[model samples]
Target: MIIKEYRIILPISMEEYPIAHSYTTTAVIRQDLALGDDIEISKSEPVTNIRLPDGKRTSGHFVHKVYHLRRQVPKWAKVLAPKELLVLHEKTWNAFPYSRTEFSNPEFLKEKLSLRLDSICAPDRGTSENIHCLTPAELAQREIIYLDIAGEQIPRKEYKAECDPKIYRSTRTGRGPLVGDWQHSVSPVMCCYKLMTMDFKWLGLQDKVEKYAYEAERKVFCQFYRQMFCWIDQWYGLTQADVRAMEEDTCRQSCSRANRPQGLFGSKSAVLLPARAARLVPESKSLSLPLDPSTGF
Candidate 1:
């Protein structure tokens, strides 16, 4: 016979959860949250203890204390200048599915969200006018506060982190150019195989793809791409000479940047002017345009 002892985990309030407050856009992430709020869980300390077979009490938290879930805000998202944490008091608020917004337009929300027949959001749907009209059962539902910037939903990809900063990454070598990675040429635009194909689909031809013979050389496909741009320029009343002049100027600018003196960044290539930073990407190994539009090389 053996006696077993188990230590139970006490659930902490949302306020006590380390990540709970990080989501807040307020000046102090945790100031609004009180220590004694209605809680799903609570703990006096962040850790729970378990006794080992040798009777040693080892303590550990749910996550490594050193690793915080909500890390630094992405540089791009931060540049968007998000303001206000919009809280939805009621679930019935119509219009966008987002329950909360980081950017506040309170008056617009108040005026727009309504149950009135003529209200812009309601659309004559027979739903209760106010949240108070709902029963306790109905009131019990999932509440989510989503981040919104200015007037648009933050990109879905932004919410999900693609790279882990904590993990050290070694430089990759001798690999074939993957589908979406940039082309080999150094230029004023970091034109990738993916971006070009997408640009081809969205910008130049709404539904048409460039036609070529089965034995067509790589230059043929690239020329088709350039010709489409030239055609677009012609449509916009630009002559071939104007196109040539513009191409020369752009090429000169690109070459000047490529040969410019190296700066504090150590590598000459790394030191790009403000305008040039968006231009050149590190050269890819591939020399040819992807033949397959569906799966770029």
Candidate 2:
């Protein structure tokens, strides 16, 4: 298994991040739908009773989203990869200030592959020691990376001037235009310490796929938080009820676009087709891994 810890510092406070996160995620879902990618929210409900590892009780929300990326795959890989392999199942347990998300492929890859993320939001400068309570063995193998939202260089293809932190200033709260040495000067700074563990047990593809997962996680973090800061004007001043109502409206719209029944809160779709083991073997050199969504961050 590959273990990585990504620390991302943002200008928002811990109290206000949940609203911004939900609002931005809803917007991202719509954008994905517009790009011909289908997302099914298999389950979404409120969790009022959650027992933490420290034996403390808390309340939070739960959401399960399955991503369909048939259109995003290369044509050649489609011939070798099965329909089931094209989908990713995500279950997120979000208790603000702390959350855990798991991503898995179909049943066939249950033992061959696995991914889990644990995040802790704090008001410090990424100085927490073992925030996720990782084991000694896990800590020895873990890689820590600090993601500078205002300074990190993303791919040119994914860059947007509107999302650039150096150019965009927030109209609400006035926290924008993060210039040099902003981490020391930014007021009300918080860090999302995210721990990602992934393992792909394929014979020839295990190493490459594990390395790719780290990069994928990093990309998702930088992109999501950059947009989170840039879109502050829209989500800033929103309450919990306000965000929940927006989520409901987005769910209805998603159902309409998917042409499926609405309000299937606890339903799981049996849409993946089973394929033979031989058909699952693809040319490793030409295979590209799908990017997981930014959930529970």
Please write out the lDDT profile of model 1 over residues 9-44, one tens digit for every residue: 111121221121111111111221221111111111
lDDT values of the candidates? Answer: 0.20, 0.66
Local distance difference test, candidate 1: 0.20
**Cα RMSD to the true fold for all candidates:** 27.6, 7.8
Best by TM-score: 2
Tens-digit lDDT track of model 2 for 10-121: 8888777767776776555545545545555556556667555455778766666676757645565477667778777777766666777778887447667788887778
Q: What is the lDDT of residue 88 in candidate 2?
A: 73
- How close is every model to the real structure, measured as TM-score? 0.14, 0.83
